[model samples]
Every structure is written in C-alpha cells, then in structure tokens.
Target: MNAPITIDTPRTRISALATDHTALLLDYRLRNRDHLAPSEPARGAEYYTEQAVASRIAQVEAEAEAGSALHLAALDRASGQLVALCSFTNIVRGPFQACHLGFSVDHAHEGSGLMAEVAGAGINYVFDQLRLHRIMAAHMPRNERSAGLLARLGFEREGYARSYLRINGQWEDMVLLSLVDDRPGA
Candidate 1:
C-alpha cells in the first residue's frame, strides 16, 4: 500500500483516498445521492454498493501510483465523517503539466466553507507536492456557488463549452476556468 498523504486544517483534514476509506465513501454517497444527483452524472444502482466503491478505491489508488490522478477525501475533524471529495484527474506531464480538478461537498456541509478549506489544501498538494503547472475546473453556468468558489480560489475563467458533459442523463454546458502555479520555478 502507498503511504497516505494527509493535510490538516482547523476544521477538517484532507487525506489521499485509500481502500480503508471504502465504507465512509459509500455511506457519504448513499446519503447524498439526491443532493448530488443534479450536479453529477447518473449512476447505476450498483454504483452505490460497498463492493463498487471498494473497486473504485482500488482503481484510484493504482492511478495515483501511476501518476495519472489523485483523489482526496475531506473528513470532519471532530467527527471524522467524510464530508467532501476532491480530485486532480487526467494529469499530463512533460510540456503540459496540468490536470482537471473536480470536487463536491456533502449537502449538510454546503455553504459552510468546508469545500474551500479542503480544495485549498488539495490544490496545494497538486501544485507543491505533485508539482503540476495548472489545474482546470468547470461548472455549469447555473451553478453560481461553484463559480464563486472557483473565482475565490484564483481560477480564471477561460471559455465556455456547449454540451461539455452528460450529467443526469442530459448534455450540460460548462464554464472552463484554470489556475496556473505562479510561484518561482513553476
């Protein structure tokens, strides 16, 4: 097993997703199914099962080892409950050191700045530890909250895409945004 990467904050801790996290992830997904459905692609009934989550955890772990992706889970400090998920996917090296960023917070934790804390920590890992050059994120134009969050995190709007992805069974448009590492040597 790979060593877990953990980042600590005042209210939460962000850690690399591991197989041991299967149960917590499964519970979080099942509990937030309806709350997250609109923002996510439709999933089959099997997707929520513990077995499926375990399989996904294994796949992500392998991807992390292969340097193609990283998945982080944010847990409440006090309760140790899984409260958010963040990922840097499709990482590209060589001349293009970048990846797509994706994240979501549990419904009960929304509007509480938990995601901001978690995402900040995760982005730091991507740029500092992983040494990625850029992180791109996209959200539906209607998702004002996500737009605001990305702006606050220093991601600049790049463009708009029509029918960018299939979400909840229909094609959805997305506003593209990206943040480049501006530190020296980045």
Candidate 2:
C-alpha cells in the first residue's frame, strides 16, 4: 500500500472540485443556503444550480489547463467529505505574480479552522510552490469572521473599496487584504 500522505493542515485535503464533486457541493450549498448567503458577498441561488456548477467546473478546468488559475474543494481527509471551496482567480503572472483568493465554507463547519487551513495551504502554494509574490482576498466589512480569518493568516489590510460588488442585490463595500512574499531570499 502507498504510505499515507501528510500535510500541514491536519487531515484536510483540497482537490479540484470538478463535475464529479457537483452533487456534494450542491448538497452542501442547499443545506446551508441561508448561512452561505452572507459570506457570498455576491452571487445567489442560481450560482448553485447544477448547470452553473458544471459550467464553473469547466471554467476552472480550462483556466487551470491554460495556466491561468486554480480552484479547489476542501474535504475531510479521513471521511473524504466536502467542507469548503476556495479559489485563486484573476491571476496575473510575470511582474504581477498575484491572484485573488475567494472561498466559502459550509455553514455547519464554520469556525472549525478548516477554511483557514485551506487558505494557509493556498497561500503557501502560491508563494512557495508556484513562486507567486502576492495573494489578495476581499470581504464585505460586515463579514467579521472572514476578516478575522484573513488577518490570522498574515494578510495585511490594504483598503476598503466602496460599492465593490453587488451582493444579493445592493452594492457592498469590501475590505481588501493581501499577503506579499517579499523576502530577500525569495
């Protein structure tokens, strides 16, 4: 048998959430629809539909294959259960070497550190593994939990953008946070 793999985020596994994982993702989204509504900041029920989910999977796959972006679904290593979804989108290579982080956790699993674990792993991958210099995440000001998580992960608050995104309907302000890998050795 192959030896068990180990990762920093304790029994947390993140993998491409393709069409194969659509049912799991849809179930979680449906069950926690209300709780997820707040963190979404943008998007709605239509975003969780099977067609949309399949389309997103295709988009992410194409982007990954083209070396443009990376998206992952976080799962419990032991049970192989879906817990959250995260992505690095709007990636700019070369001089920019940066991407934006977006994520959402099942309402039942919030505050369990799973999302944080995923974010930390993504930051490490972007900075060390992919040789990217910076990563950014933005959250609605009222989303205290997300802001806290970003801060705990060493992201510095950059600024707030007015009417950054239309959430549910109204335009919402977003607090931008970033982690820049500017070490001399890097």
Q: Which number leads on lDDT?
A: 1
Question: Lowest summed lDDT over 10 consecutive residues: which window, candidate 2?
Answer: 1-10
**In candidate 2, what are the lDDT values of residues 46-142, reduced to their tens digit?**
9779888778778878887776777777777777777887888888888888899998887777898878888788777777766888899899998
Clashing pairs in 1: none
Clashes of each: 0, 0
Alpha-carbon local distance difference test for all models: 0.93, 0.79
**Pairs in steric clash, model 2:** none
Model 1: residues with Cα > 4 Å off, grouped in runs: none
TM-scores for candidates 1 onward, in order: 0.97, 0.88
Which one is best on TM-score?
1
